[model samples]
Structures are given as structure tokens and as C-alpha cells.
Target: MALTTGQHSWWRPLAGTALVLMATAVMTVMLASGTEIAGELANRPLDSEGTATWGDIGDTALALLSIAFAIPAVLLAAHCVQHRPMGTVSSVESRLRWRWLAICLALALPLVLFTVAVQALMPAPAGKSGDLAWAGTPAFLTGLATVWLLVPFQAAAEEYAFRGWLLQAVGAWCRSPWMAITPQALLFATAHGWGTVWGFTDLVVFGVVTGWLTIRTGGLEAAIALHILNNLVSMSIATAFAGAFASDDTAADMDWAAVAIDVPMVLLYATAVLWVTRRRERANGTDVPGGPNTSPPPPTPQTAAASRPTGYMDPAAEA
Candidate 1:
């Protein structure tokens, strides 16, 4: 089906969501079946010294499947690109001033460092060392590369589907900024149900910040860039710690106390982002939709006529 323009109706968003869910289901089945096949194949003898691990094969299959899951989102983004650019996309380079980027990174750095420090303070679990010795192995490295590529694609797809397209679509319908952001944030959080409960909570909070960024900036690129950077940093830190602290029997235990410190740091970073962006908008005289600067212009004569019908024929009949 052809994609719709703007938020004229609910059908487009519903259709897009249906497409995403169907694609997800198809990818899930493919991965499950491929995993079973890989498991059977792994049992066979090989000429090489080491046999393939089912875990490695499964990871590879899942990575490939993730790309498949992103197909619908990619199509939807293409559709948006063709129809009209979201105001946010147009403002990317201008709004994402170097100063703001630096502030965001600076803010994020302290939170991440504090998180790591708190983990250090926590008592080490018996047999738990967060090390990635396995990562150095040839097989594992190959699998890791595959996962790295696919994981970002998955994250991008989800953000595009929800934050990018859905936000625009809903805003068009409700004609209110809050209506657009609220449900999308809820949906974004709900989508993370498979993650740890705390992880889901973190995503919801992150979603709010990211959604606001999209709204404030008038484009998805800023939010997308930030989201990607955040994930890349998070994964890198986690992997490094996991490799360094790997134990014979257990994974490294997370320091929850550090998380307590990190949360406030993220809020501070978000505040900085808002300040930088709002300043830019004001300087440029750009109309920030739904913001305080937004005011209805005086009605033109044509607008007044359009509202009121003439005696001879209905305005609708004239059209």
C-alpha cells in the first residue's frame, strides 16, 4: 500500500505498525528455525581442530534476522523522505551546534564514570569477574562484529518507527505536541519489555528526553545521533568491563548505586540540550511549533470568508 502524507488519518500509522509487527514475526520465525538448524549442524564433525559453537551460530543468525526486521522501517523512512522533510531534519547542523554536542558528551561522561566507579565499590560476586576473554577468540570476534552491525540497525529501526515517523504522524492527527509525544514515549518503553525491568525503566526515561529533543529540534537527526552515541558508549563500556572482569563462573555484577548517580547526570545533560537548542531557535527567529513563541496570526479576509458561507451557494458547493 502507498504511504500517507502527514497525520490526516489514523490509517497510516496503524498500517505502518502492522507492517513492522508482521516483519518482526517473520524474522522471529526465521531466526528460530535457523537456530535449530544451526544446532543440528554444529554437532557434525569438522576437519578443523575446533567445532563451531551453537551459541556463535545462533548469534550470527539473530544478527542477520535483525536486519530483516528493519525492512519496514527503512521503507517508511524512505516514504517520509519523498513526501516532505520533517522540520527537525532541516535544522540538524544548525541546531546541533558544536557547543551543545560538547555539553551532551561532557554531561554523559560524568554519569558513565560514576556508574563505573559505583560498580567498583560493590562487592565482587564469587567467581564473577567482568572480563571478555572469549571476545579475543577468532570465532567470538567474528560473531561480535556481526552483532555490532546488526544491533545498531535494530536500534535505528525502532527509533525511526516510533520516534521519527510515529511522532510526526500522531502530531498531525492530534494537532497538539503533547499528544504526539506522550503515546510514542509510552510505546517506546513498552517495546523494551524483553529487557530487564530496570533497563525498561531507563528506556522510558530516555524516551522522554529523546522525544523532547525531536520535538524541540524539529528533526529526528539530533535524537538519532544522540541515541546512537549513547548506545555505542554504553555497549563499549559494558563490553570492556565484561572483558576485564570476566570470571570462570560468573558475570560482573552491576553497581546499582552508580546508577543512582548516573540518572541525575543524564537529566542535567538533557537540560543543557534544551538550553542550547532554545537559544538557537530564538536567535534564528524560527517558529517553534507549540512553543511559547507560537501565536495565531490575525485572520485574513479569505480565511474569514472560508469560514462563513455566502447566501447563494454553500462554500463547499463553490469549491
Candidate 2:
């Protein structure tokens, strides 16, 4: 379901984008500053790169939560500026499809696990330390807890901003999904900051894949599912190993080897989710109809009358 139609005006997307950016900037700064203060108080100041080390649970939460703030920022922009149901930013249906999200998540789990398994078997890069040491029970549990708790929201917030709000904003102005999807994909990659050429390209590929999936499957569920699982798996490994958290690496820092593995995994997920979406649509004999974009079956006369407000009179009846 595309956000191509509605009470859309050419300027709404521009206004909404500005609002989202301003709000996100404000919230991120507030939360990040607070985290920095807490870190200083605990004698665990952030490194030069502003990254938290292993066992620095407070700072880690702050970092993730800063990005998480984008969720409300986008929703607020959609509702207040776009003059549409806040849920519309979620999907064409104006709300999340819980079952569909769950299904996508299940589809993603195996592929992500397989990718992780393969990566585990691959040789480490030449400059990488192969030293193996556990991060102790307390540190590991705390880090894992933080990652699991906040990573989903962090991932979802990104989807809502780039794929949801930005995509819809552009789609409102242009009928072409490519027009809507491509800019956001490029922006999403840029937001990660630059690292290796392979890593940057890989991220762009991810954004494009997910953006297409959001339109094809009629929601952000598929993209969100893949992102959540991928992050959880990667961070869980980092949490388990001593000194892993001390590194300032992000997905943007990935090398060619990592990109080769990641790009294919995302493609596999997109293909599988599309196949399922098509199958479900064929079975129902229509587009998966849950959002405002899909027309619902007409109500029966009696049902319609019963559903009307008490003492309300239809114009036709009155005449």
C-alpha cells in the first residue's frame, strides 16, 4: 500500500520532513547529553569516538535511545503536518499488521541465523584480533539485555523515518515508487556515516531492498523484521566477547567480506517475503486489505443502520 494518495498537498512532505528532522535533533541531543553525564558520574566516560566500552550499559542505552527518538518524531510529523491518521505512517492500512510482522520475523530468523553461522566459519580479517575471551556473566547479561530491549525500537525507528515517512512524503508528490524509494535509500546509507566503500554500497543496497519491500508488501513489517533480527544477532555476538564493545565499528565499518555475505541475506529475505505476500493475495483474491488504501466490503443495510450513531439521521432517509 503506497501513501501515494490522501489529503496530500505538495508542501506537506516538505513540512513534515523538516518537523521530523528538528524533533529528532532535539530529542537525540537531550538523551545523548544525559547519557554522557551519567557516564561521567559513573567514571565511565565515552571514548574519543563517543562509543561505550564493554560493560558500559548506561551509555549504550543512551546511544540506542537517541535513534529510537525518531519514532515519535516521524509520527508527530505525519499526524500534525500531514493531516492524516498517525497510523498511515505505519502502513497504507493506517496501522501495524501484527500477524504479518510476526510472519516476516519468523521468515527472517532462519536466514539471519544462517548468515551468522557462515560468518562464524569465515576467517577473520588480517588486522582483526582473534583472541577469544568471555565478557563475564554480569557484563554479558547487561549488554545483551540492553541490546535486545532497545535494538528493535532503534531498528523500527529507522524504518519509520527513512522507509515510512520519507518514502510516503516523496510518494505523495510522485506516483513512481522508485522516485519515493531511491532518495530515502541513499539518505539512509549516508546517515550511517562513511566507512569502507563496500560497506557503504552494502548499506545502500539494504535501504533499496527494504524500501521496495515496504511498498510491495504494503507496509514496513518486512523491513523491520529483517533489521531487528540482523541487529540482534550481530550485537549478541559482540556482547558475548570481551573487548568487542570497545570497538567503534558499526555496519558502516564492515569490510568487503562482510558486505558479500550481508547483501545476499537481505535479498533472500526480500524474495521469500514477496512470494508469501503474493500467495496470500491470490488466496484472498485481492490485495492484502488491512489499511486505508484497501477498500473494505460494503456493509449490509441493517448493519449500517445499527452502526450509526444513536438518533442520527441519514440525508437520504430524511429526504
lDDT of 2 by residue, 1-319 (tens): 1223235567878888999999999998887677667667777745668753324566567778889999999989877886666776776556788888999999999999999999888888788877879989988998999999999999999999998888877766554667777899999999999988987899999999998888776678898999999989988888988877767778888888888999999999999998998778766664552433344587576554333211112212312
Stretches of model 1 off by over 4 angstroms after superposition:
1-7, 27-68, 71-74, 77-144, 194-199, 238-259, 282-319
Task: Record all residue pairs in model 2 with backbone atoms less than 3 Å apart, i.e. clashing.
Answer: 1-218, 93-291, 93-292
The per-residue C-alpha lDDT of model 1 at residue 165 equals: 56
Candidate 2 is scored at a TM of 0.86
lDDT of 1 by residue, 175-283 (tens): 3456667787778877555434555556666677777676665445445555545544544443433232222211112234434554565576677667766676576
Candidate of highest lDDT: 2
Poorest lDDT segment (10 consecutive residues) of candidate 1: 307-316
Candidate 2 positional error at 48, Å: 4.2
How far residue 79's Cα lies from its native spot in candidate 2, in Å, is: 0.6
